[model samples]
Target chain A: MSIDPGMLLAIAMMSAVTYFTRLAGFLLASRLSLRGRARAAIDAIPPAVLFALIAPVVLTHGWPETLAAAAAGIAALRLPLLGVIAIGIAAVVILRALF
Target chain B: MTVQSEYQSSTADEIRQGLADIAPVLVAMVPIGLLFGAICTTKGWAASDVWLMSTLVFSGGAEFAAIGLWKWPIPYLALFVSTALVSARHILMGVSLAPKMHAFKGWRLWAAAWFMTDEAWALGERRARRQTITVAYWFFMAVPVHLVWVASTVTGSMVGPMLGDPAAIGLDFAFTALFIGLIAGFWKGATTAWVLVASGGASALVALTIGEPWNVLAGAAAGIVAAWFTATEPDEPESSSPEGHLL
Candidate 1:
């Protein structure tokens, strides 16, 4: 597995762009000085982002995935993180098998 | 209790909790990291490249996108754009996360930003919701995830395990499950319910239509808009509303 200059360039570009993305939001937010509805919008980010992330997996994958996601999601309300993971994996596996 | 002593004790507690908090995610990452490295190895990419990308680029989704886009001639612009697009969510994540890390001073805040993966950011936000996010907590939560990701990727390049379908074992659902739990922590009754339904539905619709990265932005924007319209304003510091106390 020898190194290639071309590959190195690609890696550098990816790294530079990614680091910038990570920092840009913080820098941008620092200057904004938001309040009220804007602050509420920001506070809502965690859940909003989370749901956006898993939506395709849960909603579009299939019935098994959707149902399994619900099982795991409901488990989340009552279980610890590890327990929720167990339930989700188990539910998906079983549902996939049944369907 | 003196302020200094309280800070010291809480720092220690946060450190331990931070490690504990990230433990399950680290476990979930193992198969993913291994699979990533194995794919690179099978694709005939150099070990150094695998390790470097994992260490430097340090984003699983972007790195995976790069692998998909890899070729002999190397589509440089396509590669760069895809990497940027796949990782663009970090911008939104950082926007939300920056305001909460009040205790992170100066360079520490910037430094911490390096490890703000989806899992790390979600866990950090969870921590912030319950109490102040201490430096020790953030570092301990984020740093180990980075190290483990790098280590696992390198190992996978070497071993190149023939991991069968991850979906078959339900390994793919691990992140979804973990996120489900994390998202549940943000529950605030109907307001949050509306925010999630809008975000998830829009995100899913976009993923089915326009696809990747755009879906994230579209959905998040929708959720934020829902938040603005539906949420009771947490405008005052000592207000009785649940949001007022937290936000």
Candidate 2:
């Protein structure tokens, strides 16, 4: 139990900040009404945010990763979610090895 | 049978389905969790402290950023601000999730928030699209993953930083692959195309130039802007704009 108090405090404060942000959206959404364009915007958020999250690998990583993402996107057209992920990982792994 | 009994039975089924739905993701998370813990230990974080960090913070990006910034003296204020900044997207995610959580009552809703991560929030949104989201279903989906994540950190810390360069074997690609699969769930044709391009392009651009989490914000903002613009068009389905084809 040699845990440093400063380290604990630091992690706690970070957690507090994280928890606050987690709640901030819930509070903000309750305060306002989502309709029309706002609704569309919210709807667009999932795909956008998700794609953006992976943009580093999909776009900047290399042609291999970009190709793998495209292959996975096509597989998404046919396969279920798990299949798409499997194919994507396989595609990236293969493409990286080949290149 | 009474209606109450039927509801109870249905709730059990819902929880089961929730667990089943997240089963693959939970499995996929093992390596990533170990990677996070291992990296932190390499940075000289105590195993107990690493475990606690995962248990309390329960976020991947923010934790990684904090670990990157971890040094002997500890940059307390800097770490706090960076974590807040990295996790700011959660606010938007929460806004998107609020309306969909109709099945959760007051306290249940707040409790559910504690388990809310990007994946959980996204899964909740996806679930809401098809049916109502109950606290039972939500917790079943979110909590197990959270537990696995916490457990992985502890294991990783104890084992120490063993996995070197997850990308060489393509473990790093797992998360990106998973996100692509999840995003596919939200497809909406032309509108989705624009949002994907705008967000992906802006995020990639920013990630290349600036770095880390700011890319998420830029991409999200661009995507939202694209969505707003797309929604403003006349209700009639327009032909794929030449501009879109240009890309």
Candidate 3:
């Protein structure tokens, strides 16, 4: 398929906005030390951010996908990283095909 | 502990250490990159487009959002707005890492910032809390993951057409499974577990109500606020052996 210049432009802008946050963090963090309530919030940010990233995908896709993903995730928790990935992928495929 | 353990010798050495620390995460990351690549390819994106997206945006979630928008042929302004909303977590990531990375200056900080991802931030934050400031360690962690991401995208783009739908083959499960693995690995105690549940539950509720990218923002805001309110005293002893250091 032909690459659209518009799509490329959009991608570049998205990239810039995305990179801005990281750059901002690095630059800003160097200037000040976070502590107290701020530190507490920062500490909590990862799980919150991660959940934000994951929850929507699972919800939009439906419960079956969520359950399957959860099961695969649990399986991944028990196995080696590669094995977990393989099993997770397998579970999704099987569940999709069966359901 | 040996002197080697006491101080990272050089920037290159520190980067190597960081990358070594992040190796286990690649298992989770590779599949995600592959999926993203597959999605882009399936959308009929060329190999160059795939690489450019991966390299430039360097954000799995944002890239996914961009591709989703691409399907609609959304205008560039709308795409940018959606991406910004989706990637709002980066603001939090920036805030969290700011204190720890205060020593870095100019271009070096910029480069490191570019490498920050959810996985990288989790690992980096944990290490920074432990006070591991060797530039090499951070570099090592970020560079390899970045490479794997780009490489997997290339692989996915090339093989994406030939492969059937990821949902058809169950590869989609890898994304959630990887996250679960990450969550489980970091489950230090009840507080952490509760925080996760609250975040997930809140995010889902908001998502069900608000829809699309708004759910992401609402969920994240809810989780952060809940965590802030339920903040625990840092009296508990730090774990000496953090997970993901086996290699």
Candidate 4:
């Protein structure tokens, strides 16, 4: 249950780096104006970063996961957020059971 | 500024609203947090270490990456670099949100930065673009997720043996589902199609070939590039231009 000083220090380092990243944007934005292409890039970050996370999970897992994600994506278009997630999870479970 | 004080009265409502707004994602987070704690425990990590990491690091991707890379001697420098890279996305999240969050100052601003996470950032971005939001809203949205996450991780670490396999019941899909829904929430018209395709395609390609965090960076890079071109359409007026659109 006890952690060594090294591990604690290492964890501290991780937290520091993460906090730095979080703060960097705000600091940078204060100093510099984000316009034109720079603004576009920053704007693109949300969906892009999110998709980047999602894409690999879908592709690597193959059809079952793909179908499930697709169901989620499609449901997300119309259903409530919780409903969409429910559909996606249900799809995975149902598909897993069926095949 | 005087404006900050005007917001002071509404803080309670904003926090409550923020908590309600993020409620959907919280459902999915429970299993993931528990799964994370269970994984750490299985890896021989102390329960305290699991809680400490979740509370301090507060990043699912980075913490998972760290545990995946865990071994004797800890590989301190390598672990730091990898986790940092995996979490590098936070920089973009902060940048994307900074404009909307400009009104927040002092401790409020610092706390917002500390509480920032991909889910909260996504939700905040949607709200900020649509309407003005308060610092309280931001904190409420972000902090509760952290609290629930930490609690679930602790629960998983302590009683991991009883929970059985998270994936067996398809609870693992909850993470992906939540992201899918959140991405949908960020949808911004037709142009988003190509941007998402490019992001997803590049990410999948890099993931299949190189693996780990690089795919995340590559996807973000590709998305930004693709969006730049798409936003620069000849017909669109400069004033109406899609500068900050997710596409």
For each candidate, what is the lDDT?
0.84, 0.80, 0.69, 0.81
- Candidate with top lDDT is 1
Per-residue CA lDDT of model 1 for A1-99, tens digit only, reads 667889889999999999899988877764454567777778778899889988999999998889999999899989989999999999999999999
Task: List CA RMSD, all candidates.
Answer: 3.0, 6.3, 5.0, 3.6
TM-score of chain A of 2: 0.88
In the range B89-190, model 2's lDDT, one tens digit per residue, is 888888878766655667787788888888888788787666667778899999998899999877877775556776777777777777887888888779
Docking class of 3: medium
DockQ of 4: 0.63
- What candidate 3 gets wrong by more than 4 Å, as runs, is A1-8, A34-36, A57-99, B1-16, B71-74, B234-247
Q: Once superposed on the true structure, which residue ranges of model 2 sit more than 4 Å away at CA?
A: B1-9, B232-247
TM-score of chain A of each: 0.90, 0.88, 0.67, 0.85
Residue pairs with clashing backbones, model 4: none
Estimate the overall C-alpha local distance difference test score of candidate 4: 0.81
Ranking by lDDT: 1, 4, 2, 3
Recovered share of real interface contacts in candidate 1: 0.77
Which model scores highest in DockQ? 1
Per-residue lDDT of model 3, residues A1-99, tens digit only: 466787677777888898887776656555554444455555677766776667765656766677666775677557755566666666667666766
Q: How accurate is candidate 1 locally (lDDT)?
A: 0.84
**TM-score pick, better of 1 and 3:** 1
lDDT of 2 by residue, A1-99 (tens): 477988889989998998888887876674344556767788788888888888988999898899998988888788866787788888888999899
The alpha-carbon lDDT assigned to residue A40 of candidate 3 equals 53
RMSD of candidate 4 to the truth, in angstroms, is 3.6
Clashes within 3 Å, all models in order: 0, 0, 14, 0
